[model samples]
Target chain A: MQDYSAHIQCSACPIRHRAVCARCDTDELSQLEQIKYYRSFQAGQTVIWAADRMEFVGSVVTGIASLTQTMEDGRRQMVGLLLPSDFVGRPGRAVAAFDVTATTDLVMCCFRKKPFEDMMLHTPHIAQRLLEMTLDELDAAREWMLLLGRKTAREKIASLLAIIARREAALQLKKAKGMLTVNLPLTREEMADYLGLTLETVSRQISALRKDGVIALEGNRHVNIPDIDRLLEEAGDDSDGGMLV
Target chain B: MQDYSAHIQCSACPIRHRAVCARCDTDELSQLEQIKYYRSFQAGQTVIWAADRMEFVGSVVTGIASLTQTMEDGRRQMVGLLLPSDFVGRPGRAVAAFDVTATTDLVMCCFRKKPFEDMMLHTPHIAQRLLEMTLDELDAAREWMLLLGRKTAREKIASLLAIIARREAALQLKKAKGMLTVNLPLTREEMADYLGLTLETVSRQISALRKDGVIALEGNRHVNIPDIDRLLEEAGDDSDGGMLV
Candidate 1:
């Protein structure tokens, strides 16, 4: 990890409009600026190990990170796929509850926990925003539960792609419709971990979907959806929308 | 549903101390009382359906409710298992997002959504408490994701029982240790749905646990854990503590 605190300004931060500080007014932004720092991590770096006493609460300003848990014997489950603007850590919690790792080169805008918690008590905007984000996270977690518990392997694969593509579109203020493209944010093994499937199964399912013309591939990591609606149908979702969290 | 507003007061409510309004002072309590009402549902009744226009936000006062999502092809997944003091509806969301069914006879204390949203804005204590609760719920949901995605059938069943027993003990300010007892809140089929297993799988696992003397059972619902530590071990959890959400 490296401190890039001096390299960025909150005003120039790419995720400023979408992060935990999104609701902050000018004065509030300055207040946040007082406590905020930036931490950068390389791909595959462990950001926080479970049970570590984290000194900060933060949000991803760039790239992706994963929140995962492992069993006693070593089985792993990916519980959260964090994207740009997604808040990380719990305000009142000092100990990290899950292993957080950067899935790609990442940057986070962080605030010291003590000051952040104190500020939350005094700032309605910050607290309200955090609450809203937490609720959204809960909803996402529940939806992920549904996918893990009920969806078939192929459906799970399709759902993961659909979720990524839709979110990608959302970031651009558009709908994932007739034709679109998306990058597979997770690798095959990571996808397997996230979906609770064997890596072979994930590869086979992706191949099956490709052979069925539901999607086009530009390699293992880039996906082209020839028809997004058909992809949703394959994902066992409604055309209007599916997989909100 | 029947109105039971006259039968209860917040001061006498069983879940008051643990509920959404847990931090409310006298003035806040009175304001809440003015907007609150109680609705009761019989066992096996539908409390709310997906896409239905819900009129209020609420919390369960008694009994259990299951939040479920169904695919167009009729497959279902139990996404949330609501217990007493568990919140019922999203405060700002007027459309119910999942099918909420009473797994047992249930009573909910509800507040109209508009006022509840207004009150949340004005009451820092309420918002702060809600944020805390929401964060806790998010943690629980993530742990559920781990269970659904990683645990074996036997481990899943053990985890569910262990979770219930722990929560039951928590209510009494006791730790679930030697010879603890708990009731199966969901039927075999519901457990099957919740655990991503076939009904036979759930039953088989339960029997296997009994045969191993990891648990003892009387009738279909009551369970006796002769060794809670052993039970937690079987649940793929740490003996010191595990499964907080």
Candidate 2:
């Protein structure tokens, strides 16, 4: 764990426009500056365990994290992937409902739960912005459900690739069209957990996609899309309508 | 379709305390009343097709409705089930993302899109309440994702039964404990669509549960859980933890 508690001015933040505090005015940002702190975790660190008490709610400042659930018999499923600017922790809940683990060395901007909840009551911008983000997340989760329940193994791989490619493009401030590349942030086992497939199946599907020319692999972790539309077609998504999200 | 334009007083509404207007004051309610109207749909009627222009947003006043997505080949998946007081339509979005159909004859309290959006902008209470509800819905959706992605067929059936039982209990203001009876709002085929199971598999699992004394069936649409804990155990959930939702 990296404990760098130095205060960073809100205006200097990289995620200023995309984070939960995106809509906050100067006074609100100053208020958040008073309540916010930074925390960093090494890759594979468990940030919060399921059912544990969570004292803070925050957003990812850098790197990746995942929310996962495990059965009594040890079957685990990754329910959410949190990337840069993604919000974490429920506003009104004291206890965390899922285990949140950092998939890469990560930094988060956090606010003490009580103050944050109080701030939410006073700031309509925060509440409304959070609502919009949550709704978007809900839409994304439903799309994931469709992939998990109905899509075949190959389609699942294609869909995951497309999702990552889009996210990567967005992060780079580039259009998600024509030639695109994405570095796989997760391992094959993690991809399997996220996609409801086994490691062997995930590996097989990646190889299949590579062979089919829907995507090219420069290495195990890097993927190149020759044509975004063809990749979307393989993912069984609407290639023209941009409806997959 | 039934069109009922008669205005119902907000004070006399059954869901006054639980709907999106739950946090609204008398003045706000009067504003809502001015803009609200009633629309009813027969069972099996399509309320909104996917990608169609959504002219209004509303809450279910009576009976069950579902949001479903259909693939090009006609495979369908139910993304959401809307019961009484459950919200319909998304604010800030012009097009409906899913095909909403009434599973039972339904009545809704609706507000025109432009007015509702404008009202949400002016009313912090409505926006906050909607944020809370959307968060709850997101939590429920993630739980559903776990079931869809990882649970076994038997566990899936048990989980669905438990979900319905809990919802039914909540609607009736009864405790979801001890011996409980539930009337299945969804047909076997509909349940299959929601659970990602074939109708045959659903039937087989129901029969298996009945034979094993985990549940008792009075008819196709009526189910009795002899012991709620036992059912939860069969569902592979923590009976004491209340994590199934």
Candidate 3:
């Protein structure tokens, strides 16, 4: 059973406060409804082709999507990960610049391009909020550039684990003593793509980390951090702990 | 004698339009004058410290600069190359996140931060223009992210050359058959920092490109491209050539 509610309410919703859509009012949501539609994609499906015509802009209501770029030789790079409540698509552009693929079952709350741009023009706050988010994304991208260009292979692997662990910790979960656990949302191959390394390298690095007692692995995708400080040291970051702050 | 008069104009001005200060109106310029100052740095001078207090926001009125991040062990990544017209600071940020350094004899047009933000509230147009330029910078950052996260070493070098050559071509200078050249602008060490390679790797890759006849080197700091298409192919990029188009 699927839930497809048209109204955009901020309170009591699972994604309330965190999602950018939370900023909109009932009136703005109503205006959005006049020009909006709903769409869903199955896991492993591509929602849009690279450089193909894009007639809509939208946000994710549920599930995860990834924005990826592919080379002619079949090499792929995952440039962005779109989680639930993440925004997708672009306004003022007629073509999608990258491929939007569903990494899991996904639902999108979409708006037709023309009317959405009109709404952006009429609603100054919307554009302002978008600007702020875009700036934040830019900062994140630059930070990633540093990681990709300068970090060692071990450092890269550690950084990736730290990022996942921090993100998972922020999901309003309770912390337990002597046990820190995080689920690996991505496969080794996907992690390799994101880290600019090969799958074999990713596998080897994970094993190395485990052998060095920096981490404990349970199953293929579950990570247990015995000591967060040890994990941070393995990451080669400042002793500021694994949190981004 | 300095030609300050020749450089003074608004963003709408036809001849002197490269500096970010060009976005100011006459009144805004006067306001800027009250809080502004000029400083010059010799080539290789560090202008700002990463993670330190940033007292001002400014632009390069002449010459070139770079924004770079360094690892704790001294590995470096050039996050941005600041050409004329490039804004040098973030508005809401109180401390520098990366180090800024001059790559040539640099003259800057700067404004004190408190006064600038105060003015931004009153002059929506300036804020709007700033927003547009910021958005453009963000796009450039995203493009760089793809370069760092995905490109091979050879592709990275070729892409950097192509970017420099394309921007140089846009100045509409007279073309010389043997002079489709770009001044290296960066030293071998700086190139290493920017490309995430060692100095030896940078030299080796440049030699390989020359040996392959993809590009011609004139001394160590100048490059000549026989054909843009050849360069693009070596970059592993499609010859959409939309940049020049």
Candidate 4:
């Protein structure tokens, strides 16, 4: 886990233009600065427990976290994955609805809930940006629901890889094409929770994809795509591979 | 379908305080009125096909509509259900991502896309309210994901019943409890799609619940819950059954 706690100016933040505060002007940014602080969590740490009152709202500054639900019988499902620049916490709701855990060493830029809510009331840019981000998250959730409800095990694994690759490509500002390499952020167990499969199934599917040449495994945590379009086809998504135009 | 095309003033609208225009002042309402129109669809009518261009955004004024996705092999999944006062259409995006179909004869209050986007920009209240509504929808989507990924066939059916009953109760300003009757807006086939089950499985589960006295059938579409708590228990949800307060 990298320690990034050294006070960095908001202007110098890597996710300045992509986070919840993306639309804020200098004055609005200063207002946010007064109420904002950074917090870090080690990998495997629980950030917030389900049904507990949340004291702040924030955006992921680095690393990954997941929102998950646990059943009475000990079954679990991952509902949302927060990557760099993804927003965390509901603005109006005080209680967290799912348990949030840091999947990797994580850093977050957080705003005290009440002050942030007050700032949103006075800043149209912040409110509008948050709205756009929420809509995007809703769309992503619906897409994941389709995968959970209908996709085959192989398709589910393929879809998860494609999603992660697309996000990684976006972060690098590069079009995914002939060959791409991605680091699997979650473990086999975590992947099982996200895809509604068992760890054994996840391992089998990965081995299948590798044997079929859709992907090449460099190590347990690394994947190399020989052909991005082929992988997308297996995923049952558009062959364009979600290229940003 | 109701011909609500007979120009009802926004001031008298049943959802005036609940829809996207919830925060609008009299002057803001007049601005919305200038660009608004009414449209109605018959039961089973397709409102918009997935990936098609959408020309307008609207609020459901009556009846039920659903957003669904169909795979190449004919497997379908219902991603969203829109009841009275639910907003439809993405504001910033030009294309519809899901096929929206009317499950019952439906009425909607619509605004031309360009005009509605313009109105959203100038009316901070409208934008703010839309943000709030979108957030609520995101939460609902996450909850649905949990049901889709982690529940058993029986639990899924019971959960669906609980959700519909809760929504119906909320519409009437009452909490779901005691003897509660709900008119299911979707057909058995549609219910199967929403629950990610075969139609036969859905039917069998419904019959099993009836036999177990968790619910009683008035007709194919009408369900009477003698004890709402028992139904919730079967649903594997919080015993309070999603009471707002």
Candidate 5:
């Protein structure tokens, strides 16, 4: 058996506290380390395509990946956006259901499918952790559904920005208050795809938000939110601040 | 203590084969039955509101319930449509996350929260089955995201009809291949909230589909499809047909 433990240390990984292995104890971690390997993908690379046979199930270790679906006419909608620590692939199903692509340079900690399923039977921690993660993803997906189905183009832009900023703030705790800067992983066209708007609408809405003093753009990819609460308001979120995140 | 087992037999339950209790054996089912009781809600009744304390987690036993979120200004989006056998309530959370409303008269099999959580800790089958159900719901939610974010109003209508038809077919089993009729649980206004269209737009699209011979309407509720395959095409689904289900 290959000693896969040398790939990465779970102790020092950035996403250690949040990933599927979050609830793992030392022995369970060692078991996972033995079966795990790391895979990397460049920006704009396909991680896995829908209906393809997947040999492994994994978690996003670094950067961003997107779960997207394309219609027969070539129209695409991004269903889920994966930041570090978000899971990928489903257990029990050999074929992937949606196209997963690396929207940013990506790295994944993977375990071969069969053994992982077997281990899950014996390891309740992993299965429980996966359930929690899946539940959270389901909630996020529902929130995104609300954004897609009802929010206006301008609200969509603000909501996306606020979501990205809030996620960033989650990682760098000190930068959450007052003014904050966030780098958007998607381009304008991609944002349009995610929000169900045309590229022109996305661009126009971003400009409109900037002009309205709800946000500021530092560079092409960097957005400056002088007040996070103000941005949330523009997103049509409630004063409770629980709407988008 | 209250002789709850006398309330219902797991074997006779309609959703037994599909719900969170699906994998439970006779012994496990006995434990569930001890803690289970039935709750009924009338059409248009609010089952639970967002953030309200929920005493139990349960499964929809009959009719339809909708998971919806509303903004301060009164914009509402229906995030999930629950059918019989669909699970309800998050396991770890004490409060509900969305307003669950019975779109039709509904019945649910409920287990009080504390005992249910304790039961899950000991019963791998229940937890495993719940995990599987959650994962399936997540997949459905993502598919819904795609519909909300990308599909046109006409395509959206077709997709909703196709989804309801396919789900109904899953229960009936014999009607999968060809022509079929489906009972739409949501009214035009409810459907509008669901599909992100105004009521007028929904009525117009339904009229357009009927005029084009894509679907036939009987009164206000039942929809007749002469060709399910043709309807799927109008929904922009691929030939292999895994898009909406």
Candidate 6:
């Protein structure tokens, strides 16, 4: 929807100042410009079919998206969440392995797959940045697996809240104080899917957490954590708190 | 435990012919020989704590191991199964983030953490290989997330069996027959942890699969599939056979 392919135009994009291309010179950015494109998806739209032939790879410029896998019987799991500055699609792979869906009105900074792969060969920084990002994703996925496989329903809900609180806090660049508040971006059903629970279970756990004073509700999709430490405790996390509960 | 640090010599090691250092010339091999060590662990031994300061990183030279995460209340999830040739350790980070354990009598090719990191910097090929391996591991982890988060207990068991069968078949380097036999390497409780189910549920599902003619049980850990396709169907796999299901 946004035409960003005209030239190597960091002057107009804030993300260019700090994203993976921060170190790129004009020549490298010009090469990227020749291959890049832009695309948009409305909320609730599927961006790519699972296992479909993918023609391009890109990063999120604005809005949220999800990487999901589904069973033949229609059961689904959300594997990766794409936020702004997050890369999408795999290099050296021809087809998309998961269905990517827009969780909000989405805009992506894209690149033609063939040219991007070729450029990756000549550009060490791009590959290096990608490796760093992939490793980070892997760590997050492993942490999620812990939640899915081992955490109690109550702990799972608290963990999710803590994660959202941390992310939203980071996005807004502030520390939460007493009665720290943020909006829940996901529906109850989406939360259930991400936490491996039913919607009822999610609702019940949220209510329980509220009763325990770990969190309070201002309105639907609005959460207030009285103390971040208490929320982390409810998440069943240790004191040395960098593990995402 | 072997005092491999004292016996740090690679001259007679079995893995020398087929390891990360296999391509190195005699001089390079000798250089590696000075720093390399072999460590062994008994079955069910904890190799490293999740939050411990790691002094070394290694590759599995023989036998089986697992990477796992545990909650404060004792809930545990096995996040990774390490077969021979599989690597362990994080680059540019010190300390273990997950517990590593030996699931069978295990031997590993190890290097001191600092030296290994330094070696990685100088040997681009080694870094390249590590990148490739980590990418594959990331893919497997994502697929496992689907099973843990979405599939029913019955489907999880079927999917796990199908995966083991496929891996065994590949290792043997032969086309599988219409009927395939597999030695189940995991106990019911271990399977339960891997599948995100209780042991009772795991046992019940195994019984149900056998009763439904979806699988034939020869013993506690051996299974026979009359048709791989049937098992795949039981796995709720896509018609196109993408590994997602």
Provide the overall lDDT of each model, using Cα atoms, as 2-decimal numbers.
Answer: 0.81, 0.81, 0.71, 0.80, 0.80, 0.76
DockQ of 6: 0.56
* lDDT tens digits, residue span B1-245, model 3: 11133343444222124433445578776776677788899999999988789989888877889988777887788888887666777667787877999999998878788887787656544544555555566556655656677778888788888877876665534443445888788898888888787888888899999999889998999998888777878777643323210
Chain A TM-score of model 6 comes to 0.90
What lDDT does candidate 2 reach at residue A35? Answer: 85
Angstrom error at residue A66, model 6: 0.7
Candidate 2 regions with alpha-carbon error over 4 angstroms: A1-11, A14-16, A176-178, A239-245, B1-11, B14-16, B173-178, B239-245
Per-residue accuracy of model 5 over B1-245 as CA lDDT, tens digit each = 01113223444554455665656789877877788899899999999998899999888877889999898999999999887777899788878888999999999888898998888877766666778778888888888887888888999899999888887676555556767989988899999999988999999999999999999999889998988888888887664345333
Best candidate according to DockQ: 5
Model 3 lDDT, residue A43, Cα: 87
What range of 10 consecutive residues in model 4 chain B has the weakest lDDT sum? Answer: B1-10
Best first by DockQ, ranked:
5, 1, 4, 2, 6, 3
Better model by TM-score: candidate 5 vs candidate 6: 5
Q: What is the per-residue lDDT of model 2 for residues B14-122, given as tens digits with 9 covering 90 to 100? A: 3345656666899888888888888999999999998899999888888889988777876777888887767888898898878899999999888898998898887
The Cα error of candidate 4 at residue A133, in Å, is: 0.4
RMSD of every candidate to native, in Å, equals 4.8, 5.0, 5.3, 4.6, 5.2, 5.9
What CAPRI grade goes to candidate 1?
Answer: medium
Q: What is the lDDT of candidate 2?
A: 0.81
Could you estimate the TM-score for every candidate? 0.92, 0.92, 0.85, 0.92, 0.93, 0.87
- By lDDT, the better pick of 3 and 6 is 6
Clashing pairs in 4: none
For A130-190, candidate 5 gives per-residue lDDT tens digits of 8877887888788888899999999999898988887777566555778899988899988
Instruction: Specify the poorest-scoring 10-residue window by lDDT in model 3 chain A.
Output: A1-10
TM-score of chain B of 1: 0.90
**Candidate 3 stretches greater than 4 Å from native:** A1-29, A173-177, A239-245, B1-36, B121-131, B173-179, B239-245
lDDT of 2 by residue, A113-134 (tens): 9998998887887888888888
Q: Candidate 1 DockQ score? A: 0.72
